[model samples]
Target: APDAPGATLTALPSLDLSRPAWRAGFDETPATVLADGAAAAGAIRRAEIATCIALGAECVGVAGHALELTVDHARTRHQFGRPIGAFQALAHTLADLTVTVEVARSAAAYVTRCGGDERSAHTLAVKASEAAVTVTTEAIQLHGGIGFTWEYPAHVLLRRAHAAAVLAGTPDQHRRALFALVDER
Candidate 1:
């Protein structure tokens, strides 16, 4: 097959880091010498947005589960002859976490329904990533010392939230993207 006019295919070695990240570089060679690749840049962008959406959804799910675990722990873990969850501070914190998780879920679902809307996808990714990190961190706090230990799953969820937040695009980056889109309009 003939190479596409404005595209080239290069085989570059890559390294995968934590949270599904890759590093690759294209050579500075002239385009004439490289094999042309299919798919326009727009198509690639759309695919990347789709990937971000899926990753955002995963983060939301993780946050949701972590919230559930924290809630259950609060309800069952007794303190002062009563469940700690009965305390106002703990109850309010749990309520906030629940709201964040729900908002993140709504954002993810909106992006999923919107198909490949780049702005919406970016916003969703940012919101979901932030929610995951916040919810997971709060979960660890609510779990007391047990959350920090390896035996508990709070640490695992925190690590995943951190990783997911960095992947696709960081919250700051997504925010900037949203700002740019708003500026364009």
Candidate 2:
């Protein structure tokens, strides 16, 4: 990937996230043939599966961390002579976010330990992307003005989740492919 023939490695415009454009142009450009036979296909399949699993795990981590930060902030930052977390609405939202992060974590861990099939990757992708993006966005809102600033981690997590979601195709694309695979069964 670092050096491949017929691949321009054109850098896309700056992303909102901090990640470098490590993957691009393999589809559009007729890159040099890395492999061709059935064995090669199998290797590629395995690689894609690994990538998807890793991405899902990464999203889980991101969302979990963001949620932790938000919860800490809520507990410490007070409103109307009480901690923000004491408010019923915020406490409920945090509870939901906690569930979301935990569910994604469990799914990622299950797929990691069970050696799940190709279709499992898509399911994990949809869940992880949704959870990570949702938690980080909520973190940003809950953190008030501080969340949007570079000083806080919420914005960074949001950007990371957004960027990672597009890597193995967006969540919606994966959902469609997952349904197709299921229907094929």
Candidate 3:
């Protein structure tokens, strides 16, 4: 072990149970006798980005499912002898949510098709993360009182959105990176 190059791996302790999240931090302590530490570091960074992209897509999928549940509720829940979804206001809001989910899905699909481009992948991550939060929030609002209760699945989707938004990178951080990318062009 002393003569050959090696990398150390450590499993960090859990942070807290109040919030559902996973985090790991690495310190790039100098590796003695290592010829190319930079290359290893770069590979690790790429892996992190790839993970972020995958999680972002997952968040989008979660939001899409939440949307479907809300729409179903709206269509079936009747008020004044008519389905609530028949109302123009609720219908329009659901339509807009559908558009957001579709756009986020497209961005996610783009990232899958072009996995080699880190910039586009990060862009998709940003879009999907934001879309998840926004769409989930809207879904909760559409679900009315029941959505606020812990017994309902809408709150679960909202909690997941909040957790995903902060994972890998915040929406603001990703937006800054996207702006920088645009500036570079």
Candidate 4:
């Protein structure tokens, strides 16, 4: 109902271009007993896994859009009497990124379809987030100094990807947990 006990919601400002975020600050706040504490940890884990899976999808969408923007720019923005997309180097890079995005997309979809398999959820999150960051960064670079500008969407995509990466747990944290899980098996 009300803000959870001592949890004060704060609107966080950022250079994320458009989407704003919030933080819940919990101090010596009052506690309202919701349910049994024993299962809380398990519930929290499931929630985190679900959140990561959703964020993975979001990452795919952002990366895919950024890739589209880069493709369009490469086709229209000419250099040295030809489109940059015509260059072998840039073409190869684009092709690689395209494959990466597609793979990430499929991974995200697979994890979602599996109902967020705990073993693979974090991995997919890491993959999708990294893919988004990679594509958006390249999108900006391909834009020639305009990528990070306030007028560019690449910066927004990058910001969103970073935010998503950190929301459920950073890639390093996810990888660490994954490694630990592997070790346990």
For TM-score, the strongest prediction is 4
- RMSD values for the candidates in order, in angstroms, are 5.9, 2.9, 5.0, 2.1
Give the candidate number with the greatest lDDT.
Answer: 2
- lDDT against the true structure, per candidate, is 0.83, 0.85, 0.79, 0.83
Evaluated against the true structure, the overall lDDT of model 4 is: 0.83
Q: List the pairs of residues colliding in candidate 2.
A: none
lDDT, candidate 3, 132-153, per-residue tens: 8888889889889999987578
In candidate 4 the C-alpha lDDT for residue 70 amounts to 92
Cα-based lDDT at residue 56, candidate 4: 83
TM-score of 3: 0.80
- Candidate 2 structure quality by residue, lDDT tens digits, 1-185: 64565455666654454777744555555455778899799998888777788888889889999999999999999989999999999999999999999889887877866777788787888889889999999999999998998756888888888887777778898789888998999
* C-alpha TM-score for every candidate: 0.80, 0.86, 0.80, 0.88
lDDT of 4 by residue, 42-65 (tens): 788888888888888888899999
* Regions more than 4 Å wrong, model 4: 1-7, 26-28
Q: Which ten contiguous residues of candidate 3 have the minimum total lDDT?
A: 14-23
Tell me the deviation in Å of residue 43 in model 2.
2.7
Q: Rank the candidates by lDDT, best first.
A: 2, 4, 1, 3
Mind sharing the TM-score for model 1? 0.80
Question: Using alpha carbons, what is the TM-score of model 4?
Answer: 0.88
What is the number of backbone collisions in each predicted candidate, taken in the order shown?
Answer: 0, 0, 0, 0
Question: Which tens-of-lDDT digit does each residue in 1-185 have in candidate 1?
Answer: 12444335544432212344333434453354232345566667878798789889889988998999999999999999999999999999999999999999989878867875988889888989999999999989999999998557887888888877776889999899889999999
